[model samples]
Target: MMIKELEKLFVRDLEKLRGELDQYPNEETLWKVVDGISNSGGNLVMHLCGNLQHFIGAVLHDTGYVRQRDFEFNGRMDLNQLNEEIGKTIEVIRSYFKDADSETFDGDYPLEVFGYPMSIGYFLIHLQGHLNYHLGQINYHRRILS
Candidate 1:
Protein backbone atom coordinates (compact mmCIF):
# COMPACT_ATOMS: atom_id res chain seq x y z
CA MET A 1 0.00 0.00 0.00
CA MET A 2 2.99 2.25 0.48
CA ILE A 3 4.45 4.27 -2.35
CA LYS A 4 7.57 2.12 -2.47
CA GLU A 5 5.57 -1.06 -2.66
CA LEU A 6 3.33 0.41 -5.32
CA GLU A 7 6.33 1.54 -7.30
CA LYS A 8 7.82 -1.92 -7.32
CA LEU A 9 4.56 -3.43 -8.43
CA PHE A 10 4.20 -0.82 -11.15
CA VAL A 11 7.67 -1.49 -12.45
CA ARG A 12 7.08 -5.22 -12.48
CA ASP A 13 3.79 -4.84 -14.29
CA LEU A 14 5.30 -2.46 -16.82
CA GLU A 15 8.12 -4.83 -17.58
CA LYS A 16 5.67 -7.65 -18.09
CA LEU A 17 3.55 -5.55 -20.39
CA ARG A 18 6.55 -4.44 -22.42
CA GLY A 19 7.69 -8.01 -22.75
CA GLU A 20 4.29 -8.95 -24.06
CA LEU A 21 4.39 -6.13 -26.57
CA ASP A 22 7.82 -7.24 -27.72
CA GLN A 23 6.29 -10.51 -28.82
CA TYR A 24 4.44 -8.82 -31.64
CA PRO A 25 5.90 -9.53 -35.08
CA ASN A 26 6.74 -5.92 -35.77
CA GLU A 27 5.62 -2.34 -35.36
CA GLU A 28 3.99 -2.34 -38.77
CA THR A 29 2.22 -5.51 -37.80
CA LEU A 30 0.86 -3.72 -34.76
CA TRP A 31 -0.09 -0.77 -36.92
CA LYS A 32 -2.28 -2.94 -39.13
CA VAL A 33 -5.76 -1.50 -38.83
CA VAL A 34 -8.24 -4.02 -37.57
CA ASP A 35 -11.57 -3.76 -39.33
CA GLY A 36 -14.43 -2.17 -37.35
CA ILE A 37 -12.14 -0.95 -34.57
CA SER A 38 -11.61 2.73 -33.99
CA ASN A 39 -8.12 2.27 -32.63
CA SER A 40 -5.03 0.61 -34.00
CA GLY A 41 -2.08 -0.84 -32.09
CA GLY A 42 -0.11 2.35 -32.63
CA ASN A 43 -2.89 4.45 -31.17
CA LEU A 44 -3.17 2.28 -28.12
CA VAL A 45 0.53 2.49 -27.47
CA MET A 46 0.51 6.25 -27.70
CA HIS A 47 -2.53 6.51 -25.50
CA LEU A 48 -0.96 4.34 -22.85
CA CYS A 49 2.22 6.40 -22.89
CA GLY A 50 0.27 9.63 -22.73
CA ASN A 51 -1.81 8.46 -19.80
CA LEU A 52 1.23 7.34 -17.84
CA GLN A 53 2.98 10.63 -18.50
CA HIS A 54 -0.10 12.57 -17.47
CA PHE A 55 -0.38 10.78 -14.13
CA ILE A 56 3.29 11.20 -13.33
CA GLY A 57 3.19 14.86 -14.28
CA ALA A 58 0.16 15.52 -12.13
CA VAL A 59 1.57 13.79 -9.05
CA LEU A 60 5.17 14.86 -9.41
CA HIS A 61 4.91 18.45 -10.60
CA ASP A 62 1.26 19.44 -10.68
CA THR A 63 1.68 20.21 -14.37
CA GLY A 64 -1.07 19.48 -16.86
CA TYR A 65 0.05 17.14 -19.56
CA VAL A 66 -1.53 17.56 -22.95
CA ARG A 67 -3.06 14.41 -24.34
CA GLN A 68 -4.16 14.11 -27.94
CA ARG A 69 -7.34 12.31 -27.08
CA ASP A 70 -8.70 12.42 -30.61
CA PHE A 71 -5.38 11.57 -32.17
CA GLU A 72 -5.33 8.39 -30.18
CA PHE A 73 -8.33 7.33 -32.22
CA ASN A 74 -6.40 7.68 -35.49
CA GLY A 75 -2.66 7.50 -35.28
CA ARG A 76 0.17 5.36 -36.56
CA MET A 77 3.59 5.03 -35.00
CA ASP A 78 6.54 2.78 -35.66
CA LEU A 79 7.32 0.06 -33.21
CA ASN A 80 10.70 1.51 -32.31
CA GLN A 81 9.16 4.88 -31.57
CA LEU A 82 6.40 3.37 -29.50
CA ASN A 83 8.86 1.30 -27.54
CA GLU A 84 11.02 4.33 -26.90
CA GLU A 85 8.10 6.35 -25.66
CA ILE A 86 6.99 3.52 -23.40
CA GLY A 87 10.48 3.24 -21.95
CA LYS A 88 10.56 6.93 -21.20
CA THR A 89 7.15 6.78 -19.61
CA ILE A 90 8.22 3.94 -17.35
CA GLU A 91 11.30 5.85 -16.25
CA VAL A 92 9.31 8.96 -15.43
CA ILE A 93 6.72 6.96 -13.49
CA ARG A 94 9.38 5.06 -11.56
CA SER A 95 11.23 8.22 -10.65
CA TYR A 96 8.05 9.86 -9.46
CA PHE A 97 7.22 6.89 -7.28
CA LYS A 98 10.75 6.65 -5.91
CA ASP A 99 10.74 10.26 -4.76
CA ALA A 100 7.17 10.38 -3.49
CA ASP A 101 6.73 10.86 0.24
CA SER A 102 4.23 9.07 2.40
CA GLU A 103 2.22 12.26 2.67
CA THR A 104 1.66 12.17 -1.07
CA PHE A 105 -0.35 8.97 -0.78
CA ASP A 106 -1.81 9.56 2.69
CA GLY A 107 -4.23 12.35 1.89
CA ASP A 108 -6.99 12.34 -0.68
CA TYR A 109 -6.14 14.89 -3.34
CA PRO A 110 -9.22 14.90 -5.48
CA LEU A 111 -8.75 15.26 -9.24
CA GLU A 112 -11.32 16.02 -11.91
CA VAL A 113 -9.57 14.41 -14.83
CA PHE A 114 -11.49 11.67 -16.69
CA GLY A 115 -14.68 13.49 -15.65
CA TYR A 116 -14.76 11.70 -12.30
CA PRO A 117 -13.64 12.44 -8.77
CA MET A 118 -10.57 10.41 -7.94
CA SER A 119 -8.16 10.44 -5.03
CA ILE A 120 -4.44 10.52 -5.73
CA GLY A 121 -3.97 6.91 -4.69
CA TYR A 122 -7.07 5.84 -6.53
CA PHE A 123 -5.90 7.59 -9.67
CA LEU A 124 -2.60 5.76 -9.62
CA ILE A 125 -4.32 2.44 -9.12
CA HIS A 126 -6.74 3.21 -11.91
CA LEU A 127 -3.94 4.06 -14.28
CA GLN A 128 -2.14 0.86 -13.46
CA GLY A 129 -5.29 -1.10 -14.09
CA HIS A 130 -5.85 0.78 -17.32
CA LEU A 131 -2.37 -0.07 -18.49
CA ASN A 132 -2.93 -3.73 -17.73
CA TYR A 133 -6.22 -3.72 -19.56
CA HIS A 134 -4.73 -2.24 -22.71
CA LEU A 135 -1.76 -4.52 -22.52
CA GLY A 136 -4.19 -7.43 -22.67
CA GLN A 137 -5.84 -5.96 -25.72
CA ILE A 138 -2.49 -5.44 -27.41
CA ASN A 139 -1.54 -9.04 -26.73
CA TYR A 140 -4.86 -10.28 -28.03
CA HIS A 141 -4.47 -8.31 -31.21
CA ARG A 142 -1.04 -9.73 -31.69
CA ARG A 143 -2.36 -13.25 -31.28
CA ILE A 144 -5.18 -12.59 -33.71
CA LEU A 145 -2.88 -11.16 -36.32
CA SER A 146 -0.33 -13.88 -35.96
Candidate 2:
Protein backbone atom coordinates (compact mmCIF):
# COMPACT_ATOMS: atom_id res chain seq x y z
CA MET A 1 0.00 0.00 0.00
CA MET A 2 2.86 2.38 0.77
CA ILE A 3 4.50 1.76 -2.55
CA LYS A 4 1.23 2.35 -4.32
CA GLU A 5 0.76 5.60 -2.50
CA LEU A 6 4.36 6.53 -3.25
CA GLU A 7 3.81 5.57 -6.87
CA LYS A 8 0.98 8.07 -7.11
CA LEU A 9 3.10 10.75 -5.49
CA PHE A 10 6.07 10.08 -7.72
CA VAL A 11 3.92 10.24 -10.84
CA ARG A 12 2.19 13.35 -9.63
CA ASP A 13 5.45 15.12 -8.87
CA LEU A 14 7.00 14.07 -12.16
CA GLU A 15 4.01 15.42 -14.01
CA LYS A 16 4.53 18.67 -12.18
CA LEU A 17 8.19 18.56 -13.24
CA ARG A 18 7.07 18.17 -16.83
CA GLY A 19 4.94 21.24 -16.40
CA GLU A 20 7.91 23.17 -15.08
CA LEU A 21 9.96 22.13 -18.05
CA ASP A 22 7.14 23.26 -20.27
CA GLN A 23 7.00 26.67 -18.64
CA TYR A 24 10.57 27.56 -19.45
CA PRO A 25 10.71 30.21 -22.17
CA ASN A 26 13.62 28.54 -23.91
CA GLU A 27 16.23 25.86 -23.47
CA GLU A 28 18.94 28.39 -22.78
CA THR A 29 16.77 29.93 -20.11
CA LEU A 30 16.54 26.63 -18.36
CA TRP A 31 20.31 26.44 -18.19
CA LYS A 32 21.02 29.95 -17.02
CA VAL A 33 23.01 30.39 -13.84
CA VAL A 34 21.48 32.90 -11.53
CA ASP A 35 23.67 35.29 -9.57
CA GLY A 36 23.68 33.24 -6.40
CA ILE A 37 22.27 29.91 -7.48
CA SER A 38 24.80 27.75 -9.22
CA ASN A 39 22.44 24.99 -10.36
CA SER A 40 20.63 25.38 -13.63
CA GLY A 41 17.15 24.00 -14.00
CA GLY A 42 18.24 21.83 -16.89
CA ASN A 43 20.95 20.30 -14.74
CA LEU A 44 18.43 19.61 -12.02
CA VAL A 45 16.18 17.82 -14.48
CA MET A 46 18.99 15.58 -15.62
CA HIS A 47 20.03 14.94 -12.06
CA LEU A 48 16.53 13.94 -11.12
CA CYS A 49 16.24 11.62 -14.09
CA GLY A 50 19.61 9.98 -13.56
CA ASN A 51 19.06 9.66 -9.83
CA LEU A 52 15.62 8.11 -10.00
CA GLN A 53 16.35 5.93 -12.95
CA HIS A 54 19.44 4.49 -11.30
CA PHE A 55 18.04 4.12 -7.80
CA ILE A 56 14.49 2.98 -8.45
CA GLY A 57 14.74 1.45 -11.89
CA ALA A 58 18.15 -0.17 -11.78
CA VAL A 59 18.47 -1.01 -8.13
CA LEU A 60 14.94 -2.11 -7.28
CA HIS A 61 13.75 -3.59 -10.56
CA ASP A 62 17.02 -4.67 -12.13
CA THR A 63 16.23 -2.40 -15.05
CA GLY A 64 19.92 -2.19 -15.96
CA TYR A 65 20.05 1.56 -15.83
CA VAL A 66 23.50 2.99 -15.32
CA ARG A 67 23.68 6.41 -13.77
CA GLN A 68 26.21 9.00 -14.72
CA ARG A 69 25.89 11.15 -11.66
CA ASP A 70 28.42 13.72 -12.73
CA PHE A 71 26.84 14.19 -16.11
CA GLU A 72 23.52 14.84 -14.46
CA PHE A 73 24.93 17.91 -12.76
CA ASN A 74 27.26 18.96 -15.56
CA GLY A 75 25.35 18.20 -18.76
CA ARG A 76 22.72 20.14 -20.61
CA MET A 77 19.59 18.98 -22.36
CA ASP A 78 17.07 20.75 -24.51
CA LEU A 79 13.49 20.93 -23.34
CA ASN A 80 12.35 18.07 -25.52
CA GLN A 81 15.20 15.88 -24.34
CA LEU A 82 14.44 16.61 -20.72
CA ASN A 83 10.83 15.73 -21.36
CA GLU A 84 11.91 12.46 -22.93
CA GLU A 85 14.00 11.50 -19.92
CA ILE A 86 11.16 12.46 -17.62
CA GLY A 87 8.80 10.26 -19.62
CA LYS A 88 11.17 7.33 -19.32
CA THR A 89 11.55 7.94 -15.59
CA ILE A 90 7.81 7.98 -15.16
CA GLU A 91 7.46 4.74 -17.06
CA VAL A 92 10.22 3.07 -15.04
CA ILE A 93 8.67 4.08 -11.76
CA ARG A 94 5.19 3.05 -12.84
CA SER A 95 6.04 -0.40 -14.14
CA TYR A 96 8.50 -1.28 -11.37
CA PHE A 97 6.01 -0.70 -8.60
CA LYS A 98 2.86 -1.69 -10.41
CA ASP A 99 3.19 -5.27 -9.28
CA ALA A 100 5.24 -4.68 -6.17
CA ASP A 101 4.28 -6.81 -3.17
CA SER A 102 5.00 -6.55 0.53
CA GLU A 103 8.29 -8.19 -0.06
CA THR A 104 9.24 -5.48 -2.47
CA PHE A 105 8.61 -2.73 0.02
CA ASP A 106 9.78 -4.52 3.12
CA GLY A 107 12.96 -5.83 1.59
CA ASP A 108 16.29 -4.16 2.28
CA TYR A 109 17.45 -1.89 -0.47
CA PRO A 110 20.45 -3.43 -2.11
CA LEU A 111 22.80 -0.49 -1.70
CA GLU A 112 23.99 1.52 1.24
CA VAL A 113 22.84 4.73 -0.31
CA PHE A 114 23.08 6.78 2.86
CA GLY A 115 25.90 5.06 4.69
CA TYR A 116 23.55 2.24 5.73
CA PRO A 117 20.92 0.03 4.19
CA MET A 118 17.29 0.98 4.46
CA SER A 119 13.95 -0.48 3.49
CA ILE A 120 12.87 -0.04 -0.10
CA GLY A 121 9.83 1.82 1.11
CA TYR A 122 11.91 4.29 3.10
CA PHE A 123 14.20 4.94 0.18
CA LEU A 124 11.27 5.48 -2.11
CA ILE A 125 9.79 7.96 0.29
CA HIS A 126 13.08 9.80 0.55
CA LEU A 127 13.36 9.94 -3.22
CA GLN A 128 9.83 11.28 -3.58
CA GLY A 129 10.54 14.05 -1.13
CA HIS A 130 13.76 14.85 -2.94
CA LEU A 131 11.83 15.20 -6.18
CA ASN A 132 9.41 17.65 -4.65
CA TYR A 133 12.23 19.74 -3.24
CA HIS A 134 13.89 20.04 -6.61
CA LEU A 135 10.58 20.62 -8.30
CA GLY A 136 10.08 23.65 -6.14
CA GLN A 137 13.53 24.92 -7.03
CA ILE A 138 12.76 24.51 -10.72
CA ASN A 139 9.52 26.42 -10.27
CA TYR A 140 11.29 29.20 -8.46
CA HIS A 141 14.00 29.37 -11.08
CA ARG A 142 11.39 29.72 -13.81
CA ARG A 143 9.71 32.53 -11.94
CA ILE A 144 13.00 34.29 -11.35
CA LEU A 145 13.86 34.10 -15.01
CA SER A 146 10.46 35.35 -16.03
Candidate 3:
Protein backbone atom coordinates (compact mmCIF):
# COMPACT_ATOMS: atom_id res chain seq x y z
CA MET A 1 0.00 0.00 0.00
CA MET A 2 2.78 2.40 0.80
CA ILE A 3 4.63 1.48 -2.36
CA LYS A 4 1.46 1.95 -4.35
CA GLU A 5 0.99 5.46 -3.04
CA LEU A 6 4.60 6.34 -3.66
CA GLU A 7 4.47 4.98 -7.18
CA LYS A 8 1.36 7.00 -7.91
CA LEU A 9 2.97 10.21 -6.75
CA PHE A 10 6.23 9.54 -8.60
CA VAL A 11 4.60 8.67 -11.90
CA ARG A 12 2.13 11.52 -11.59
CA ASP A 13 4.79 14.14 -10.98
CA LEU A 14 7.00 12.78 -13.75
CA GLU A 15 4.12 12.96 -16.18
CA LYS A 16 3.27 16.41 -14.96
CA LEU A 17 6.84 17.51 -15.58
CA ARG A 18 6.74 16.07 -19.06
CA GLY A 19 3.47 17.81 -19.79
CA GLU A 20 4.84 21.08 -18.52
CA LEU A 21 7.84 20.72 -20.77
CA ASP A 22 5.55 20.19 -23.72
CA GLN A 23 3.70 23.36 -22.85
CA TYR A 24 6.85 25.41 -23.22
CA PRO A 25 6.71 27.45 -26.43
CA ASN A 26 10.12 26.34 -27.59
CA GLU A 27 13.37 24.71 -26.59
CA GLU A 28 14.92 28.09 -25.90
CA THR A 29 12.12 28.96 -23.52
CA LEU A 30 12.62 25.71 -21.65
CA TRP A 31 16.25 26.64 -21.04
CA LYS A 32 15.72 30.27 -20.12
CA VAL A 33 16.55 31.38 -16.56
CA VAL A 34 14.44 34.26 -15.34
CA ASP A 35 16.24 37.24 -13.84
CA GLY A 36 15.89 36.05 -10.26
CA ILE A 37 15.94 32.31 -10.93
CA SER A 38 19.06 30.27 -10.30
CA ASN A 39 18.16 27.39 -12.62
CA SER A 40 16.07 27.06 -15.71
CA GLY A 41 13.22 24.64 -16.14
CA GLY A 42 15.44 22.50 -18.34
CA ASN A 43 18.06 22.32 -15.61
CA LEU A 44 15.45 21.41 -13.01
CA VAL A 45 14.16 18.57 -15.16
CA MET A 46 17.65 17.29 -15.76
CA HIS A 47 18.44 17.46 -12.06
CA LEU A 48 15.29 15.56 -11.18
CA CYS A 49 16.09 12.85 -13.73
CA GLY A 50 19.66 12.44 -12.60
CA ASN A 51 18.61 12.44 -8.96
CA LEU A 52 16.08 9.60 -9.36
CA GLN A 53 18.36 7.60 -11.59
CA HIS A 54 21.10 7.82 -8.99
CA PHE A 55 19.16 7.19 -5.81
CA ILE A 56 16.50 4.78 -7.08
CA GLY A 57 18.14 3.15 -10.08
CA ALA A 58 21.82 2.83 -9.27
CA VAL A 59 21.62 2.80 -5.48
CA LEU A 60 18.52 0.70 -5.06
CA HIS A 61 18.50 -1.62 -8.07
CA ASP A 62 22.17 -1.70 -8.95
CA THR A 63 21.26 -0.57 -12.45
CA GLY A 64 24.78 0.78 -12.96
CA TYR A 65 23.42 4.25 -13.70
CA VAL A 66 25.85 7.06 -12.99
CA ARG A 67 24.65 10.53 -12.11
CA GLN A 68 26.43 13.59 -13.49
CA ARG A 69 25.16 16.12 -11.01
CA ASP A 70 26.98 19.06 -12.54
CA PHE A 71 25.87 18.38 -16.08
CA GLU A 72 22.28 18.15 -14.95
CA PHE A 73 22.32 21.91 -14.51
CA ASN A 74 24.85 23.06 -17.11
CA GLY A 75 23.81 20.72 -19.91
CA ARG A 76 21.67 21.66 -22.87
CA MET A 77 19.21 19.25 -24.45
CA ASP A 78 16.54 19.72 -27.09
CA LEU A 79 12.97 19.40 -25.87
CA ASN A 80 12.45 16.15 -27.75
CA GLN A 81 15.49 14.57 -26.18
CA LEU A 82 14.53 15.90 -22.80
CA ASN A 83 11.10 14.31 -23.08
CA GLU A 84 12.67 11.02 -24.11
CA GLU A 85 14.91 11.10 -21.07
CA ILE A 86 11.96 11.84 -18.84
CA GLY A 87 10.21 8.77 -20.29
CA LYS A 88 13.22 6.66 -19.38
CA THR A 89 13.31 8.11 -15.87
CA ILE A 90 9.61 7.33 -15.45
CA GLU A 91 10.20 3.74 -16.51
CA VAL A 92 13.06 3.31 -14.08
CA ILE A 93 11.05 4.78 -11.21
CA ARG A 94 8.06 2.54 -12.00
CA SER A 95 10.25 -0.55 -12.22
CA TYR A 96 11.81 0.11 -8.85
CA PHE A 97 8.54 0.83 -7.09
CA LYS A 98 6.87 -2.22 -8.59
CA ASP A 99 9.58 -4.50 -7.27
CA ALA A 100 9.68 -2.89 -3.84
CA ASP A 101 7.88 -4.43 -0.85
CA SER A 102 7.26 -3.47 2.76
CA GLU A 103 10.58 -4.95 3.81
CA THR A 104 12.36 -3.04 1.09
CA PHE A 105 10.72 0.18 2.18
CA ASP A 106 11.60 -0.49 5.79
CA GLY A 107 15.22 -1.18 4.93
CA ASP A 108 17.92 1.46 5.32
CA TYR A 109 18.48 3.91 2.51
CA PRO A 110 21.73 3.33 0.70
CA LEU A 111 22.98 6.89 1.26
CA GLU A 112 22.50 9.41 4.04
CA VAL A 113 20.93 12.19 1.94
CA PHE A 114 19.62 14.09 4.95
CA GLY A 115 22.76 13.53 7.06
CA TYR A 116 21.02 10.94 9.21
CA PRO A 117 20.02 7.33 9.11
CA MET A 118 16.60 6.99 7.54
CA SER A 119 14.31 4.32 6.18
CA ILE A 120 13.83 3.86 2.43
CA GLY A 121 10.20 4.81 2.81
CA TYR A 122 11.08 8.07 4.52
CA PHE A 123 13.61 8.92 1.83
CA LEU A 124 11.14 8.07 -0.89
CA ILE A 125 8.75 10.62 0.57
CA HIS A 126 11.52 13.18 0.62
CA LEU A 127 12.34 12.43 -3.01
CA GLN A 128 8.73 12.83 -4.03
CA GLY A 129 8.53 16.14 -2.24
CA HIS A 130 11.68 17.23 -3.97
CA LEU A 131 10.24 16.31 -7.34
CA ASN A 132 7.06 18.24 -6.67
CA TYR A 133 8.93 21.28 -5.47
CA HIS A 134 10.75 21.45 -8.79
CA LEU A 135 7.63 20.66 -10.69
CA GLY A 136 6.10 23.77 -9.16
CA GLN A 137 9.13 25.75 -10.21
CA ILE A 138 8.88 24.51 -13.77
CA ASN A 139 5.21 25.42 -13.88
CA TYR A 140 5.92 28.95 -12.73
CA HIS A 141 8.85 29.27 -15.09
CA ARG A 142 6.71 28.26 -18.03
CA ARG A 143 3.87 30.54 -17.01
CA ILE A 144 6.14 33.55 -16.82
CA LEU A 145 8.47 32.77 -19.68
CA SER A 146 5.78 31.76 -22.15
Candidate 4:
Protein backbone atom coordinates (compact mmCIF):
# COMPACT_ATOMS: atom_id res chain seq x y z
CA MET A 1 0.00 0.00 0.00
CA MET A 2 2.70 2.44 0.98
CA ILE A 3 4.85 1.53 -1.98
CA LYS A 4 1.88 1.96 -4.27
CA GLU A 5 1.25 5.47 -3.02
CA LEU A 6 4.89 6.41 -3.28
CA GLU A 7 5.10 4.99 -6.76
CA LYS A 8 2.09 7.02 -7.84
CA LEU A 9 3.55 10.24 -6.51
CA PHE A 10 6.92 9.48 -8.08
CA VAL A 11 5.41 8.84 -11.48
CA ARG A 12 3.17 11.88 -11.26
CA ASP A 13 6.03 14.21 -10.41
CA LEU A 14 8.33 12.64 -12.99
CA GLU A 15 5.69 13.21 -15.65
CA LYS A 16 5.40 16.75 -14.44
CA LEU A 17 9.16 17.03 -14.66
CA ARG A 18 8.99 15.93 -18.25
CA GLY A 19 6.24 18.43 -18.93
CA GLU A 20 8.35 21.17 -17.32
CA LEU A 21 11.25 20.35 -19.59
CA ASP A 22 8.99 20.29 -22.63
CA GLN A 23 7.52 23.63 -21.68
CA TYR A 24 10.93 25.28 -21.89
CA PRO A 25 11.41 27.62 -24.87
CA ASN A 26 14.39 25.68 -26.19
CA GLU A 27 17.19 23.32 -25.32
CA GLU A 28 19.61 26.19 -24.72
CA THR A 29 17.37 27.96 -22.24
CA LEU A 30 16.73 24.70 -20.44
CA TRP A 31 20.43 24.66 -19.61
CA LYS A 32 20.85 28.41 -19.23
CA VAL A 33 22.61 29.86 -16.20
CA VAL A 34 21.82 33.36 -15.13
CA ASP A 35 23.41 35.51 -12.43
CA GLY A 36 21.24 34.27 -9.57
CA ILE A 37 20.29 30.78 -10.70
CA SER A 38 23.05 28.20 -10.70
CA ASN A 39 21.27 25.08 -11.91
CA SER A 40 19.11 25.15 -15.00
CA GLY A 41 15.76 23.46 -15.34
CA GLY A 42 17.25 20.80 -17.62
CA ASN A 43 19.95 19.98 -15.10
CA LEU A 44 17.38 19.71 -12.37
CA VAL A 45 15.38 17.21 -14.40
CA MET A 46 18.50 15.19 -15.08
CA HIS A 47 19.49 15.30 -11.44
CA LEU A 48 16.09 14.11 -10.31
CA CYS A 49 16.06 11.34 -12.89
CA GLY A 50 19.47 10.09 -11.84
CA ASN A 51 18.69 10.39 -8.19
CA LEU A 52 15.59 8.21 -8.57
CA GLN A 53 17.21 5.81 -10.97
CA HIS A 54 20.04 5.18 -8.55
CA PHE A 55 18.09 5.05 -5.34
CA ILE A 56 14.78 3.44 -6.21
CA GLY A 57 15.39 1.83 -9.59
CA ALA A 58 18.91 0.45 -9.07
CA VAL A 59 19.36 0.16 -5.35
CA LEU A 60 16.01 -1.22 -4.34
CA HIS A 61 15.39 -3.44 -7.34
CA ASP A 62 18.84 -3.96 -8.91
CA THR A 63 17.76 -2.60 -12.29
CA GLY A 64 21.45 -2.41 -13.32
CA TYR A 65 21.32 1.36 -13.79
CA VAL A 66 24.62 3.16 -13.63
CA ARG A 67 24.24 6.64 -12.26
CA GLN A 68 26.74 9.33 -13.09
CA ARG A 69 25.98 11.84 -10.39
CA ASP A 70 28.11 14.65 -11.78
CA PHE A 71 26.86 14.29 -15.31
CA GLU A 72 23.31 14.50 -14.07
CA PHE A 73 23.98 18.10 -13.16
CA ASN A 74 26.33 18.94 -15.99
CA GLY A 75 24.81 17.00 -18.85
CA ARG A 76 22.65 18.56 -21.54
CA MET A 77 19.78 16.89 -23.37
CA ASP A 78 17.41 18.19 -25.98
CA LEU A 79 13.72 18.19 -25.09
CA ASN A 80 13.03 14.89 -26.77
CA GLN A 81 15.88 13.07 -25.08
CA LEU A 82 15.04 14.63 -21.75
CA ASN A 83 11.46 13.46 -22.06
CA GLU A 84 12.56 9.96 -22.92
CA GLU A 85 14.92 9.78 -19.97
CA ILE A 86 12.23 10.88 -17.58
CA GLY A 87 9.84 8.41 -19.14
CA LYS A 88 12.37 5.65 -18.64
CA THR A 89 12.78 6.69 -15.03
CA ILE A 90 9.02 6.49 -14.59
CA GLU A 91 8.90 2.98 -16.05
CA VAL A 92 11.72 1.88 -13.81
CA ILE A 93 9.79 2.93 -10.75
CA ARG A 94 6.58 1.34 -11.97
CA SER A 95 8.33 -1.87 -12.98
CA TYR A 96 9.56 -2.75 -9.53
CA PHE A 97 6.52 -1.38 -7.80
CA LYS A 98 4.06 -3.44 -9.75
CA ASP A 99 5.35 -6.56 -7.99
CA ALA A 100 6.19 -4.96 -4.68
CA ASP A 101 4.38 -6.10 -1.58
CA SER A 102 3.93 -4.57 1.83
CA GLU A 103 6.92 -6.53 3.12
CA THR A 104 9.03 -4.73 0.58
CA PHE A 105 8.58 -1.59 2.59
CA ASP A 106 9.24 -2.90 6.11
CA GLY A 107 12.73 -4.30 5.58
CA ASP A 108 16.01 -2.45 5.98
CA TYR A 109 17.22 -0.74 2.86
CA PRO A 110 20.11 -2.40 1.11
CA LEU A 111 22.33 0.64 1.64
CA GLU A 112 23.16 2.91 4.50
CA VAL A 113 22.91 5.87 2.20
CA PHE A 114 23.38 8.44 4.96
CA GLY A 115 26.01 6.44 6.86
CA TYR A 116 23.33 4.61 8.87
CA PRO A 117 20.80 1.99 8.09
CA MET A 118 17.27 3.11 7.35
CA SER A 119 14.07 1.27 6.66
CA ILE A 120 13.19 0.83 3.02
CA GLY A 121 9.86 2.53 3.58
CA TYR A 122 11.45 5.50 5.28
CA PHE A 123 14.12 5.85 2.65
CA LEU A 124 11.51 5.70 -0.07
CA ILE A 125 9.60 8.57 1.46
CA HIS A 126 12.85 10.49 1.75
CA LEU A 127 13.52 9.90 -1.94
CA GLN A 128 10.07 11.14 -2.79
CA GLY A 129 10.69 14.32 -0.83
CA HIS A 130 14.01 14.83 -2.60
CA LEU A 131 12.31 14.45 -5.96
CA ASN A 132 9.67 17.04 -5.17
CA TYR A 133 12.23 19.47 -3.78
CA HIS A 134 14.12 19.47 -7.07
CA LEU A 135 10.91 19.45 -9.06
CA GLY A 136 9.94 22.67 -7.34
CA GLN A 137 13.37 24.11 -8.08
CA ILE A 138 12.91 23.28 -11.74
CA ASN A 139 9.50 24.92 -11.80
CA TYR A 140 10.90 28.02 -10.16
CA HIS A 141 13.86 28.00 -12.53
CA ARG A 142 11.54 27.95 -15.51
CA ARG A 143 9.47 30.81 -14.16
CA ILE A 144 12.43 32.94 -13.16
CA LEU A 145 14.26 32.47 -16.43
CA SER A 146 11.19 32.94 -18.59
- The order of the candidates by TM-score, greatest first, is 3, 2, 4, 1
User: Rank by lDDT, descending?
Assistant: 3, 2, 4, 1
Tell me the TM-score of model 1. Answer: 0.84
Quote each prediction's TM-score. Answer: 0.84, 0.96, 0.97, 0.94
Question: What lDDT score is found at residue 141 in candidate 2?
Answer: 96
lDDT tens per residue, model 4, 1-146: 46678889999988888778877777788888888888888888888888888998888888999999899888777788788889889999999799788888889999999999988888988988998898888888888777
Give the number of the best model, judged by TM-score: 3
List the candidate 3 regions with Cα displacement exceeding 4 Å.
Answer: none
**How many clashes does each candidate structure show, in the order listed?**
0, 0, 0, 0
Query: Each candidate's lDDT (Cα)?
Result: 0.73, 0.90, 0.91, 0.86
**Alpha-carbon RMSD to native, per candidate:** 2.3, 1.0, 0.9, 1.2
Least accurate 10 contiguous residues by lDDT in model 3: 1-10
- Comparing 1 and 3 by TM-score, which wins? 3
Candidate 3 local lDDT, 28-63, one digit each (tens): 899888799999999999999999999999999888
Per-residue lDDT of model 2, residues 1-146, tens digit only: 46687889999999999999889898889999889887999999999999899999998888999999988998877778899999999999999988798787888999998999899888888998899999999999999997
In the predicted model 1, the residue pairs found to clash are none
Candidate with better TM-score, 2 vs 3: 3
